[model samples]
Target chain A: MADGLDIDHIARLARLRLTPEERALYEGQLTQVLGHFRQLAEADLSKTSAPFRITVSDVSLRQDIPGETLGSEAVLRNAPASRDGQISVPRVVDDEA
Target chain B: MSESLHTLSATELSRRLATGSVTSRALVESLLARAKTHTVLGAFNSLDADDVLRQADAADRRRAEGKSLGPLDGIPVGIKDNIAVREQPLTCSSKMLAGFISPYDSTVAEKLKAAGAILYGRLNMDEFAMGSSTETSATGPARNPWDKDRTPGGSSGGSAASVASGLVPLALGSDTGGSIRQPASHCGLVGLKPTYGMVSRYGLVAFASSLDQIGPFARNVDDCELLFQALAAPDARDMTCFTAAERKPVHLPQNRKPRLGVPRALLEGVDAGVRAAFDAALEFYRAAGCELIDVALPTAGLAVPTYYVVATAEASSNLGRYDGVRYGHRAQGALNPVDMMERSRSEGFGAEVKRRILLGTFVLSAGYADAYYGKALLARTRIRDEYLKALQQVDALVTPTVPSTAFRLGEKAADPLKMYLEDLFTIPANLAGLPALSFPVGMANNLPVGIHLVGAPQAESVLFALARQFEGSHALANRIAP
Candidate 1:
């Protein structure tokens, strides 16, 4: 599994860009961690198909009235880049490249 | 610094405030001075003395007007950085949110404010609440007040340290896999991780949503209970919070001897010093008229691996919101939006945070989901079922909070797996979503040893009853950190 695992692909899927050093380090570390997880494979699943428990029932619901919410200025307080009461980011659509 | 006031519990301080013996501004100032003197402990990340002073004055004015909010009115309390406070930088001791100021207060903060407690400062924690020791903190680790050479167990190390050091009588901490209990144990303080959904999680920076529960750290059980009552209320903002009707009070039988379950197998590998401390605690329980019942958690060995799988999967998803676009730190000069996000996160998060994110992503990856994530969920159920079955005949389960006392700084820093194992005893309570409390029982090797008490669902009151009784009878009662 370690030889076949694509560390780069996993990092890309997770939207993280790891330095080569980080990639190598995490590759080894994750392998060891996942190896520890192999113990769960020894569990007998004859009785338990999937363990699901619903702690919250469907009965409780809050009223649908509009209430106090963060103002646009307040929401933009932590934005690294903002303009015109909105968070500005890198271009979403790209030119044909 | 008003040493006498610093030694008082929140409940005792509250009475003083009620009778006008001491002013809020004086209390806040004294505590702030205490914090400044002990800055070497690295317990707090950010403290605006001016803002804290202003809040204290406001609290004092309300008291002067005969309009005290509640039991916590005019009390000064520090908060763990992961839980939000309006206008404070919610760094969670990570570089990712270093400059990020919270636009709103978390439910716990809101409750504390409503009770008129001064939201004193932002306490240090494990980076993103990921590590057992605060060593992962981008700001630096919080040192144990008892002995500076050792660590105050974390990720709520700062919360526990602040209270134990007399910097504050109370502080709020979030426990996702024993962040609160372990630290409280190491620092010789009282910490509670109330039943899941007992407290609202609206404004907390999520590490593992389902497993995270906000609770309190205090010098005594009474103060812990007061803070718990303040924070444990339903909020529409958090759908998972327990409603008034859904939460039922658990009663301990008055006439019969309370039964305490001890998992003998689980206690096998504990350190000699910790084992001795546990035996002394058992003797106390036996003398106090509590029956000791031997119980077994057959699946307990799988808790660490199972926790990592489930916690990381949720952490990976919950932390996806920290991309460069919305808020928090963003990197410069990215060619495209995708590049911007990747670069930002790579630069923003710490090494420990990235490792967990990577593992989370790996486990949840398409083909591996069933083999890893699915199996983990089932194992979690088994652990929970084991606890529930054991709890039927016993009122609560007892174990050492950690296998040993606080270790020297950097002892387990190099090995991620070793650091993860620190949560061995505390993780099962989280997996089962049961309320657990950690309080100082005795000293081992000159360091405080904390015993963990796990109660059934909504059995917080019963746990407190047992803890209060133990605190009163034990020789370590009111043992303060030096």
Candidate 2:
């Protein structure tokens, strides 16, 4: 079991930008947390199979018919930036130079 | 007369409403006044008195027309902020969604409206329902009404405190791992986390999808069950919710005394006061003709560790949608989209949320998945099997809801692992997808002690029956925090 975590790498992967202070704080705390979680390695699961999802028997599925949904105006009401009834975001690609 | 209306049980309130002894408007006004008086308890994140009174007046009109909706008509109920209610700010007590208002009502909210229940306050919770105490909330920690210095065990601390303090007769809370029950235990109330698929989760902001179940907090089991019946209907919007046909098969046998299971090994390190109360509770059950059987749950110790892995993993995925564009807070001065997303998340989420996201990302990362996440999943299966096996030998398993009563605020705040251990007994039920209920048995150290009961899958009726039997004999059933 790894005793320490790469907080910077993990934060990057999680899409969170941590300050040096947060990184230091989380590095210590998460290491201790993972140290406790590492006990899972001691569990004897020789006979058990890890299913990705827990089976819930008799779950009823609705028909494939399209139904009412929130209108664009209502949906975009909470958006940080919007234009012409659409959520506006930072540019994803650079313009061709 | 209005002052005491907040203290009456939902059943009693319903009778008063039926007989015109009290108007829905009167009850809402009473609760609003009480909630304002106890603002120090920090039970509410948002309470729109005008809207609530309007809803109440509508219910009163319906009653006046002799068109009452049912037992819940004209009754006020607090809602945990995570569950969406149309036009209400659903913050989840976090800065991430600070000003966001829900455009649509969650299934639970819709059901409460359909039942003619007046949706009251936006109850506070741990940010994203992440912590055992409400300390993680961006607004502030909700103080236990029992003792303001202490926590009212959480993620649903506000829900428990609101009801326990008589600000509201009923509140809805979601439990991923003991959120509702632990708070209920600390505040001396009845809380239930129904079978995993029993309640629809259409609009409950997901914490951990598999383990998350919305339940009720009330002063007694009857009130809890009444609210549960209102919210437990299956919804096609939530595919994991079980159909009515699927839920019909499990019924508690009325002819025989329930055989209560005691996991002696798991009870080893509990506090002496809590142990004494639990022992007394067991004796009461035994004297009441319940067959007490010593059952083993050997794999239960790993439940906490297993839960962190699974819950964090799920939370990390579910919370990814708050990317600063569609909804929630967005940070300024970012050169690119990726930078903006990262900066927004860093500025938006609280410390505990960031920690979990990092831990989840780490465990699910390449090379580490097999060692941590994969192993935890295997352990989860073992834990589930152990619970199922134990249930086969007993009608229900009984344990202390928490190791001890509510702790002083900031006692476990600095220690994350210590806080996680608060859910030790409660996590197994969530992991196994079984129904569990927590009800106050007695007091320890001038604080309430709760006893927990775990039942078989889809056997909420069995758990409720057992809780009612105990509550009928226990004096602490209708207690309100001073």
User: Which candidate number has the best lDDT?
Assistant: 2
By summed lDDT, the worst window of 10 consecutive residues in model 1 chain A runs over A45-54
Instruction: Give the alpha carbon lDDT tens digit for every residue of A4-26 in model 1.
Output: 46789999989999888998899
lDDT of 2 by residue, B144-236 (tens): 999999999899999999999999999999999999999999999999999998999999999889899999999999999999999988788
Best by DockQ: 2
Q: Candidate 2 overall Cα lDDT vs. reference?
A: 0.91
| Backbone clashes, each candidate | 0, 0
Question: Each prediction's DockQ?
Answer: 0.66, 0.76
Look at candidate 2 and tell me the lDDT of residue B85: 97
Q: What is the CA-based DockQ of model 1?
A: 0.66
lDDT to native, each model: 0.89, 0.91
Docking outcome class, model 1 = medium
